[model samples]
Structure formats: structure tokens, C-alpha cells
Target chain A: MSTPLLSQGTPPVVRKKISDPLPVRILLIGLTLLFFIGFVFLPLGLVFAQAFQKGWDFYLEAIREPYTIEAVKLTLTTVAIVVPLNAFFGVTAAWAITKFSFPGKAALKTLLDLPFAVSPVIAGLIFVLLLGSRTPFGSWLGEQGIKIIFSTPGIIIATLFVTFPFVARELIPLMEAQGRDEEEAALTLGAKGWQIFGKITLPNIRWGLLYGMILCSARAIGEFGAVSVVSGHIRGQTNTIPLHVEILYSEYNFTASFAVASLLVFLALTTVIVKAVMENRFQKNSSQH
Target chain B: MGIELQNITKKFTDYTALDNISLNIASGELIALLGPSGCGKTTLLRIIAGLESADSGKIILEGKDTTNLPPREKNVGFVFQHYALFRRLNVYENVAFGLKVLPRSKRPSKSEIKDRVEHLLKLVQMEWALKRYPSQLSGGQRQRVALARALAVNPRVLLLDEPFSALDAKVRQELRRWLRKLHDEIHVTSIFVTHDQEEALELADRIVVINKGKIEQQGTPQEVYDHPANAFVYNFLGNVNVFHGRVHEGMVTLGGHSVDAPDELKNSAEKTSQTFVRPHEIGISKIRSEGNDLEGTIREIRLLGGQIGLNIECEGFDQPIDAEIPRELYLNLQLKKGDRVFVTFNKVKVFACDYEI
Candidate 1:
């Protein structure tokens, strides 16, 4: 089925559809777009309306307060740390998983994607098992003055666990399809391994990497379940923006909660915009190919 | 530089791709390792270039054994059939990649690298395409850029594996001639692997014929064409017409007709043999009670661009004899399917069929 445009001489471009019957295809697309608007855009509009009910005074006062400012700082800092480190880990893991032939390769790939399949709560528990003060390694590290649990590190670890596969998963199939031919060509041309990665492999995969990083940062910043389990939600000490929103909600401060949540909603929207831009760049590269 | 291989072999589990092959190539020579698919010609080229490690062999380049050396250590330029140009790099960057990667002390200066790359690009007549990415160039142009990039390294030897097999027929023919001219001008010891006999005959200084993971013959193109060492070489090199015959009473009996045998075979013992002659060498004419003639009926006729092929069925020969005649000569004959004709076998070479024919 296709959407046919009326024509005078030459027929207009007809958009193709996987289904039969033009009316049914149009109905299906209309329903999907309606669903997006109702479910996604409606709730977002509701949150924005709530944030501005008392005018810009409430929004500005909520954002300028020291605790709210600190929480925002902590969230941004966590994302900054998580994005680059995960990007590196992703590139390395993807390169190893795709290029080198070895035993246990399939098992390694499945393990790398474990966090994506497992619950965020269980991911948080994994860090607790390894780093909580109750365990021997944890207590020993605590004696050396390392405080992981109920601190910023704990939140970062939980975010890292849940967001581990984003960049690497994005890069593996891209690198695999691109093949090692260009890398081999560069190597033969006297480029070292790092030089090849920089000049050929990196540029080829930069768009996918950026998209993955944006998604990772979005999930890292907006994370609640995993970070909640690890952070202990101490006010003004280890509270992230999401935890701050939860704190305000528990105290029945609906306006403050919605205000902070709206801020994060804006951050997430920026992440989405970054993703859209990266995807557009990737599409241009693919069309050129 | 000269290349010599001794007892070179490569095996993959149950299949042996190359077996105990040895050859000596002179300096500044363009040798074509000509063979059918899976004949191990590319494997031999890779072994010599150090891209592949031979299971058992000694690769002596410039009088020094380099069998264990890696490709980078050997300083050999290799052009893959796919070209393998860096898609992200413009033509200039791709050409300068090798020089820029050398150690700081050994690396060429910026201007030197630029000049060398420019010079090589001009050599391949690709200077105008320098600012363009590989994706913007056509397949033939990309191959030319690949060749220029390879030459910029000033390799000790150049190895190309079916370099022109990816192009159209016309482009392939043009590139074949261009590569030959490039080789002559540069005077680099180069070895190329190809399955095209015409390219091998026209471009290579020496053609090494390989079949079934073994060398069938290695010689000048004329030597292999006019004096093939065996039946396989004769049939592989060109279209040959074969006839079963026996030496009896000091006379060669073919199709129940007698002809004088070559002098050396006159006094020899009677032996059964397979006599093979190229289609272009044998003469075909209409049967008019001609002297030393074998009667046959033309079964099929094919008109090629410059030549014509006739398939003739004769008694005592189950398979039809194929004759390739020039178009100019074809005009003088009224040969067609179902027409009776006499095929005159000229001085044909005979090989004994004692063990296997």
C-alpha cells in the first residue's frame, strides 16, 4: 500500500507501505502519532504547566537555592564522568569483541550486555556486594579511607553499571560491518595502531559513538532506581537531582518536586536533541557512502 | 629486487592450497602468476610479500632470507583487488599515510611527504583527484589511487593480486597496458596474480602457470604458447583440437588415414598417443578430394568479434573438433552447419598416452 498523490502529467511520488490498503496504512500511522502525542507530549506539557503555575518566581527560586544548585552540579558531574569513561570502555570492548578472534568471545558479548537485560535494582546490589562496608574488601578499603557506599562514587557506580552497554553496543555492529580493511591498510602504510584508530576507525564511527554517549548520559543523569538503592538519599550530601525531587515529594512539596523534575526533563530533552543531531550526521555519512 | 622461493607450501587443515612450489624471479621483472581460481597463485604472492606465513619455505629477497619477517619489516607494497583505500582519507592523505607514520627521526618532513605524494599521484595521473575522498571516485580511479598510494612508499617490491579483475573489460584492458608501461618506466620487481590469459600474455615479462596448487609451467609467453610442456599446459593456454592416433609402420594413423610422422618418431616403437594442435594452426577447407584430408561435417559455427569458430564432427572421433579461423579467411569459405569440410592438421605436437592422456 502507498500514499498516492494526485498528479496532472507525471505521477507524483508515492510513499510505500508494508501493509495493504492505503486507508488502513494511514489509519495506523495516525494512531501511532496520536499515541506519541497523548502519552509523551501530554505528560510533558502537564509537568511544564505545573512548574510554571506560580509563574517564573517558583521555577527560579527552586533552581537558585543552594541545595538544588548542588544537586544539579552533582548530576552534571556524574554524567561528565560517566560519558567519557564509558565511551572509552565501549570503544575498547567493541574493538576487542569484533576484531580479535578468541575463545569465550560469545560469552564476553553476552556478559557485556548483561546490565541491559538485568534490573537496575539488581545492578545496584552487585556493587553493594563488592563494595559495601560489610564485605571484607569493602571494610578493608574503608579502613584505607575510601567511602563508596552512601556517597557520590556509589551513585556513579550504579549509573555506570546500567549504562555500560550503550556506547559499546552501538559501536560493535558498526565496526564489524566497516571491517578491518581500512585499519589494515593504514597499518601497511606505516600508521601505528593508535594512529589507525584516530585517522580511520574513529572518524568512521564518531557519529554512532556520539549517539551512544548521549543516550548513556541521559540515562546516567535521570537514573533513579539504581542510584536510589546506593545513595542512601542523604539530604544535601549525596542527593542527586532525582533524589532531591524524591525528597521534596516525600515532604509533600509538590511544586518543588515538579520544578526539579521539569529541569531534568529539559536536560533529557537536550540529550534527545543531541541524539537527533548525531543521527542526522550519521545518515548523511551513510547516504554519501 | 629479485625474489626466490624454495619448497614453499601452505595448508589449511585438510586442504593444501600451495604445495612445494619454487621459482626464481629476476630483478625489475613483472611476473604474472597465472592460474584458475583456487590454484594458489594469490597465496604464493602473499607468501613472497610476507603477508602470509608459508608452512614450509625459504623466501630469499635480494639474497637475504625474509620468510619470518612481517609485512611492514619487509617494505613491500601490496595492492588488493578491492583497492582497500581508506574511505575517510582524501587522495593526498592516503598517499602520505605511509611516510607520516615513520619514526620521528626517520619520517619525511611535511613538505617532503607532500611533494612525494603529489609526485606519485601525478605519476598515476590522479593529481586532479587529490582533494576528493575515495567514495567520490569511480572504481577504476580508486584503483589508480591505490596504486599511487602503494608506490609512494618506495617499496622493495610491488605485489598486485588481480588488480584489474574488478574493472569493466575495456577498463581492464586499458589498465593492463597502463600497468605494463608503469612497470617499464619504474623498473620495480613486481609480481601480479591473474586468471586472465590475455592479460598475462600481454603484460607479464614471464608467465608462471599454476593449476591444482602446483606449477604446470613457467616460461616466456611465446614459449608456453608455442611449446607447452604437457597436455594440461597446452589445453589451459589455448583452445586445442585433439585426435587419438597410433604410430604404425613408421606412419601416423589418424581417423583411419595415414600421414608421415615427424622424423624422430619414424624409427620408434609403435605407440598410442594424443596429438594436440591449436585451432588457429590447423587449416580447414571444403572437401574436394584434397590430398591428406580428413572428411567431416560442420556441426556448429560461432562468429566471434574478430574470428570464427567451427565445430566439426568426423568419423572415429566422438567429440567434435574445434577450429578457430580469422574473419578475413572466413569470408573465403562457405562453411556453415551441416556443410561437409576437410580439416588439414598441420605440424601438430604429439604426447604419448602410456600412463594417462
Candidate 2:
């Protein structure tokens, strides 16, 4: 065996095992768990405790009130309008940014993200400056009896402006990363613009679109600062769930306020669960791919 | 379908991806667009397929000017480099997508679509994978599905962009043979883009070698290989030993030694020249030659498959000359590294050098 072994070649070298220290790895794991428990789990537990402490009777009574019921209805209605609108805006903006090059593209990108950095309070004020009685367009609109300030419509406008960036921001980088070749490939295969969008582009970006929608819906429901400034507090009218909760808290009704807050918390938590499920589905899709 | 591109050019801001170029591709002829990366081969293919619009050009297909027509109206099929098969749809549905989405007047019946998909699946030998998604298939299987899907529409022409680049060597070889067989059976005018010279040589009826946004050469594989138009074409196609020299009065001087020029080059002007010879064409012998041989020392030797490649160090040459011979020849000569050998240049090509190193 030794006589002929030299003629062929030497066997490949076995690589050495380079591993992190076991103690350091354990410490890292411990630190990660500690941070999650302290920062994320504790507050979540507190919200759950407050939600169930009063039992179903108190919760039902609180939710059945006209003010509370109206608030819930208003919040859902706002979400119904905001989610689809933001989804459309987000996807269109992302497609425009990723696929097309035109004048003021960088400026358009900056403007798309401006609402995210600016506070919702400031967002409400910007609309006020444009649509309030102070501006010429506001006066013209007022003459035509088209009011866009200090009402439910104003609250929607503010929420829409503040939550504008969520969907597109999520999708632009994703669409870019997936690339433009697939779309072009679809087009070249006898697919028109709409067909390509429906078949190739939409299917590929569906998960990202859902992710953005969930995030935008969550943020839209929990919006307080923008809606508060624009919504003139009238019971069962301009008052949204968040603004109503603030009103109840001011009246020293801590339990009811926390209860309403917990309901909003519940909606936000549903969004989190949806995001988790969506992420898990995305993971499954990617792994199968 | 016959395709004509007249003065096609595409510019992405400052970078000119495709300079003004024109080409004609006859119907039922498979062509390979071979080039290195960023050579605008894919761009040209895309322009023909209508996936990308030419900045200024006329795309005439079968005597119809279709420069402004979109891809959906072009009636051409395209296969992407990544396959680009719909991951959500199974093989059958993916192939049937184009037919299903056709306009009411052009739409096929359900059974017709099914039959067409089945026929294409059988043609690509992928009938068993009708229910499998792209992710579920291997690279070779996915490429077959892509080919099947491209053929489902019964297109006038088929285009493939590096269809087998993502596969392993064994799968690539298998697919190459399968693709050629598929093309011959279908008799579709196809254009496949690749940077691999081996793939181009093995497949295309004619190879169009593109370089730096221009067609460097286009001809049959043997014609391009045996008689390259320039140094770039020769070096890009395959491995060859290039010896820089000077030609004067029907004589070529290489490595301070004179060699008689071939009769074809008898009327050559007195000019600096470069000699092109394949490594396999050169032979090393134990018997020393007189005027036909150069004395050199073997610097290194490599046993590659059935051939032995030798780097010979000769006088007046900075770079070692490389020669490849069969293992039996090396065994007969008892050649090893550091052994002195006589290298002979039997047949060589001479070209006037435009620039010198």
C-alpha cells in the first residue's frame, strides 16, 4: 500500500475545529434571555394582568358603553380606510422608486419618509397650516363647505399622513432586492403591464406587502398624538379610542382608561401575532424554495 | 422567427451598455451569444425579446416592424438565467400560465391548454414533474420546466439566458446535450446567452462573440476556433501559446531563432508579429532537432487528465513557453521537471501586432 500511495496524491487535510469558548457562549445565551425577559416580557405580562383583573362583567360593561362602542367602531373604520390606502400608496411608491427613474426621485424618497421622522403632532399641524382657515386654499374649501380640520375626517387625514411610509418602506428594498429581471422576464413572456404586476411582481412581494400592512394597521390603530390634535373631543363623534382613553384618564377613571388602553393593546397584540404567523409563513416559503 | 436589429443602442445615463450595433438572425437557426460579463450580450437578447426597449432602433420580426410593441404583443418566449419560474405554481400551471391569460379571442380551451402543457412536459421529458413546484425540483429539472414553460406558448422564437450556469458541472453537461436535442427536435430559432466558451462551442449552430458592447466575431465554432480574426478573439476562445516575434522577408524570428514561414505568409511585409500556436500542437522529443527545434529547460510539469502540460524556459523569452502532450508521449520521452527538452514549432499562425508589451 505504501509503495503505490505516493504516486496518486496526498489525501486532503482535515480542518481544525475552531470554536468559541463554552463559557462565553453560555454567557451570551444568558444575556440574550435576560434582555428579552426584562425589556419585552415584563411589560407584556403587566398588560395581560390589567386586562383580565376586572373579569368579563366589568370588561363587557366598559365595552358596551356608547362612547366606548363608538370609539371601537371609529378605530376599525379608520383602519379599514387607512390600511388599503397606505398599502396602495406604499406599493406604488415602492414600484415607482425601484423601477422608474425620474426627476426629483431623491426628493420624493425623502418626502415619503418625512412622516416617519416627524412626530404625529407635527403631522397634524402641517395639515392644519394647509387646510385650516388661515390659508387661501382653506378659505376656498371653507367657502365650498369642505372642512378638513378638527373632525373625524381630520383625524383620518392626520393618521393617513403619519402612517404613509410604512408599506413602501417595507417593500422598496424588498422589491429592489428581488430585482427587476423577473418582471422583465414576465413582460417578455407576453405579459402586459397589469398582468406582470398581478402575476410576477405581486406574488413575489405578497409577504412583504402583508408585513407592511400589518405594521401600518398596528401603528394606525395605536395613533394618539396625531388623532388627538385633530379630533375635537366630542363624545361618540370625533373621539377615537386613544383620545377617549386619554379623556377617561383625565377624569380620574383609571380602571376604565386602562381597560380601553388594554383593548388598544389587544389590537396591537393581534398585529404582533399576525406578524409572527406571517414571518413563520415567509420562513416556510423560503425554506421550501 | 427571423429577427432584424437595426442601429440598436441602450444607454444607462453615463454608461453606454450597448453601443449602436446592428445584427440579423435568420429563422430556425440556433445562435449562442458568448461573451464575458457586462459585454451587453444579455441586453441585446432582452432588446430582441422586448423585455428591454432599445434607446433608438427598429426591431423587425418576420418583415413586421415591431420596435414599439411590448413583450406581450411580440409572441416570443424567454427563459431567465435564474429560471424565474413561478414558485407558487406547479410545473403544469406554470407552463399553462401564458395560455390561460390570453385574451378571449386567443384563449385556448381548458382541455387544449392541458393537452399543450402535457405535450410540452413530455417533450422536455418532465411529464412526471407536473405537480412539482420549482423549489421542489433540482437545478436540471427546474431548467427543463423553464424550457417546457417557454415552449408552452408555441412561440416563434425562444431565448435562454445562461440556462445552465447555476448548475453543477455534471448537470450542466447533461442539460447541454438535452437542450441541443430539444432544439433539433423542435426546430425553433433560439438564442442562448453564455460567457462559457465550451458551452458555446458545444451548442450553437453559430457563435456570436461579443466584447465591450461590440460583436468581436461571429461564425461557425470551427471557423472561429481555427481562424480567429484578432488576438482578442484567439485568446478568448481557448488556450493557446502566443509567442511575440518579428517577420521579415518570409522568415519569422522567435526566441532568437529563425523559423520558415508558411507559404500563405510568403508575401508578408517586414513588421513586428505575434505567433499563435495551440499548446497541444507543440511536441517535446528526446532526439535533438537542428533548425526546427529550440533548446529549453523544463521549469514545471502538470499532469492534467490524459495530457501533460509543460512550462519550458527558453533563451530570449521572459515568459516560459507552455506545451501540452499526451501522457504516453511524456512516458516515452521520460520527461520530468528540470529536464532539458527540444521544443519544436510545427505549425503556427502569424498576425501583425498593433501594440507591443
Best by DockQ: 2
**Candidate 2 chain B: 10-residue stretch with minimal lDDT:** B260-269
Chain A TM-score compared with the true chain A, each model in order:
0.91, 0.86
Give the top-scoring candidate (lDDT).
Answer: 1
Docking class of 2: acceptable
lDDT of 2 by residue, B1-357 (tens): 487879888988767878887778888888999989999999998888887888998888777887898788887889999888887779998898888778879898999999999998888778878898887787788888888888887787888999889887777887798788778888888989999999999999999888888888999999998888887788888788887888879998786777777576667777788888888888788778666678889999998889999999988776788899999898889988888899887668877776555
Residue B233 of model 2 has an lDDT of 82
> Candidate 1: interface RMSD in Å?
12.1
Taking all chains together, the TM-score of candidate 2 against the true structure is: 0.92
- The lDDT for every candidate, in the order shown, is 0.85, 0.84
**What is candidate 1's DockQ?**
0.24
How well does candidate 1 match the true structure in TM-score terms?
A: 0.87
Docking class of 1: acceptable
